[model samples]
Target: MSDRRILPSQLERMVYETIRDEIVSGALRPGEQLVEGRLAAELGVSKTPVREALIRLQRDGLVEIAPYRGARVIVPVDDDIAEITELRVCLETFIARDIAARRPTDVLEALETSIAGSCKALADRAEEQFVDRLSDFSDILAEACGNKRMKKILGDLRSVLHFIGNSSRRIQGRAARSIAQHEAILEAIKAGDPDAAAEATAVHIRSIAEDCRKAQVPNGDGRLPGPAANAPRAKARTRARANR
Candidate 1:
């Protein structure tokens, strides 16, 4: 005796999650255009739901829409990345301090479970799941942060940071290093050392920005400096020719 009808709001939320996940996972890519008619046809829904979902995405900071230009994924420039990194460092460091002072046992257990899953995913070389594990790990920290508004702020930034995090994973030796960093932060939290935990959180978040910088490719993905990024390599190639 359950209602089997799909509500319009339900449909919109589903479309929102699908598109958001696609964007976050890099399938949609930064600055990729989102066409309403096309997406509606593809999702077998009407344009209304797609349009509404897009507005919600815009509210989430995941998309930018113009009156006529349509919608595109938000592309984070280097300055955007730096500003976001600093903000996260501050917020997460504060969360670490709060959690350390409180030392909630349930939160600690949840973090332990998340870390175990991440470790296993890494061991099995499951790249996609590993990124999800990273999100879960951050979520656990956000939940334990002792402020609802702070948790929401972190959650709002999660997708953007998640994309940047996946970009960071492309760096050589970064995965192991990331796992180690997460552990360091957790260990400090467990020890109830607020200063240690805060420092670890700051360092871990900062490392992500560094890794993302190292992982940027020239003229691709909008990380910038890309226009002239190849000049040095080109110059090196020219030097080899001159030597010959």
Candidate 2:
């Protein structure tokens, strides 16, 4: 047997994980500028790996790069939340129904484990771990629904969720409330009630959206637009117009 050594190939991946963790943990604030040279210096590496890692983050939708202004952590706006919520409600409600009807044993066990992990994280006040496990509930259902496309789409959506989850957790009682909602979805799944599970998932998603919107605060460079500012523009359909 030969001993394995850390290769140059692994540096990029290592750098990527470190930066991604900082981003997701809110150690690196949203919309914070990512300077490659500084990151390389902090990680004790050259700029090459740092640059590569940032490109990966950009692909994950966690970072945004400009032509000359450099890269910054994504600060999701209200529109982003609304769009994500709508998509998740549509996709996950379907997943909840499908997975509930099928009731795959392995998937059920995974859901149970996720719930337990989240519960422990909540008691310990481990916000990062709590969010990871809580997010897993939707992810597990997405995977078990037998739709690869949906799974990948939801996976990509997890990037913006880290910021939202961190914000939502700071709101009083939200952590416990989220756990209860997850339990509701899981209980409905266990009882083999597709409609109940689906409805539960829809309710869970909508409530989270509402909470995230409330939790956002003003930042240094900008503010996440409030619901009033981000309201979806709807075409007027007045009765007077109908008379035409």
Per-model CA lDDT versus the true structure: 0.77, 0.76
Candidate 2 overall lDDT versus native: 0.76
Q: Which candidate is the best by TM-score?
A: 1
For model 1, the superposed segments whose C-alpha errors exceed 4 Å read 1-3, 214-216, 219-244
- Residue-wise C-alpha lDDT for candidate 2, range 51-100, written one tens digit per residue: 99899999887899999999998876789778878888898899999988
Superposed on all Cα atoms, the candidates' RMSDs to the truth, in angstroms, are 11.7, 13.8
Worst 10 residues of 2 by lDDT: 228-237
- Model 2 pairs whose backbones collide: none
- Candidate 2: stretches off by over 4 Å: 1-5, 219-244
Error of 2 at 212 (Å): 2.3
Please, what are the lDDT tens digits per residue for candidate 1 over residues 1-244?
Answer: 9977777777777778777766666656566799999877666678898899899889877899998899998766789779989999889899999998888999999888888888998898776677778678788888776688888888788877887776676677777888898899999999999999999989988898887776565456554322211123333323322322
lDDT, candidate 1, at 152: 85
Clashing pairs in 1: none
Best lDDT goes to which candidate? 1
Candidate 1 TM-score to native? 0.81
